[model samples]
Target: MLIGAEAVDTAVELNAYLARFGYGQGLSIQQLWAEMDRVWAEMGLDNRRPLGSQRIADFYAHPVWVLNGLFADTDPTSVRHRQAIAAFLKDACDDQARLRIADYGGGSGALARQIVDRLPGRSQIDLIEPFPSDFFRRRLGYRSEIRFHDVLSSDGYDVVIAQDVLEHVEQPIALAQRCIDATRQGGLVLFANCFYPCIQCHLPGTFYLRHTFRYVLASPALSYVGAVPGAAHVLIFRKHGEIDVAALVRRDRIARGVGPLLNLLGQFHSQMKTLGRRAGLSE
Candidate 1:
């Protein structure tokens, strides 16, 4: 929603603010919270009406504000986040001279910057973010290897990264399919922050937690690589071939039917694990 010189100025100010915190140095939770508060105050949002009062669509429609509020600092997760994707690309592109990568819902260009900075060889990166910031647009002007798109296309990228995005969408399954379709055979798809209970425009449901991975694994197009589970889970999948639409639909329906039960069991398991850890019964 920010326009003209004000947007540009805010963008510059935000960059400087983040820099002071050692942007990629893996900030502690306390440091992250303090910096987030500082950034919110700097944006003059500290006194503004709470976002809950506004329609979720309108609140998120302001890409600049949403990104600034949620991601002012790259937290400790970023190091492992970047490394996972980088490792996948390195293996996938073995013996190849160049790679094509896409970041679906990549906000503020943080992950893209990390990939380009750490990875070697010539790579063409495309960011498919519907609501990218003015800062990101400006950065695109300077970075020749990266381009921005308002929508996903049949670009057939070698690697597609979608982090902290699925939980916010209305139709996560369809979006997941789109991400899979946009990837080439043997390409990697990195998904993180999938549906879990949290705040800010997250659709109400635990169906995704129970069945999304099952659906992904059932699809003939994809192969499960691994998962890193925590407060926010990270799932990795590899595209093998074209999707089996009929099979996917069938699996989705089945998942929906049994998802609630699975969700309950999953919650119970998580609670038990937490209890065990507290009781010093877990290694």
Candidate 2:
């Protein structure tokens, strides 16, 4: 929804703009959709419905979504998205001679490329995406420093990036814990562009707030850095020593119990607002 510059004077300027952030090269949404249509025709598939109508199952089963760039387009790409990511990267990669970075649920390896470009020294990066497109994989093959993984490794890293991933998962706390566990002591964990509603497979409004992520930061294992809230909020956490597993489990239990009640309340409020608007009693 956050569109960037619609027009550029020259290809050179556009390429430089993209390269400044290590985006490498990518097609416009129009071009991406055109390619998707071709792929759909070739596969003899015809699901032309809007994104909101598409279910989570369809997203995973169809390569058209991931391979043709629909999945890539869902990421927040506004000026705010770039600024937040840049600020986090500056702090996380500062004064590092060598770094190991993990991008959890990294789609198309965009963030991995950014990390490699931003960091000053030798870096090893891993992109953990469960449903990566062969197209994207081949595109990223030239970067020997970046490796793709279907599952997260048990090994620790200096920085872990889980951008816009929590809202999609069934159990956010579990996923957050995995990111924390993979980070070394005093290492940074970036959670940017998260807690936003998406067309497919996002948690309810009750769990899409800054407080919902507090459970992870409250753990003995992590220290809160800061947050920048916008259409997509960015939250940063730093790992301490080993996590207090028992405390984390207890917090998750509480969240699960309270989440549904909060969701119901939110739904009630939304319905009331809609009714009021129809009655011309509210703006």
Q: All candidates' TM-scores?
A: 0.74, 0.66
Off by over 4 Å in 1: 1-57, 61-73, 227-233, 276-283
Model 1: weakest 10-residue lDDT segment is: 45-54
Candidate-wise lDDT, in order: 0.66, 0.64
* Candidate 2 stretches greater than 4 Å from native: 1-58, 67-83, 193-197, 203-210, 228-232, 260-283
| Model 1: how far residue 23 lies from native, Å | 9.2
Which residue pairs in candidate 2 have backbone atoms (N, alpha carbon, C) closer than 3 angstroms, thus clashing?
none
Clashes of each: 0, 0
Q: Cα lDDT of model 2 overall?
A: 0.64
lDDT per residue as tens, model 2, 1-283 = 5434543343345345444433423445455446544544554432333334445444543554443233353444543464456456666567777888888877567666665666634678888887765556777899988898988876889888887677766667778788888998889887764453433234453263334457535866688877744324667788888888888878777766765666568779989998988889644
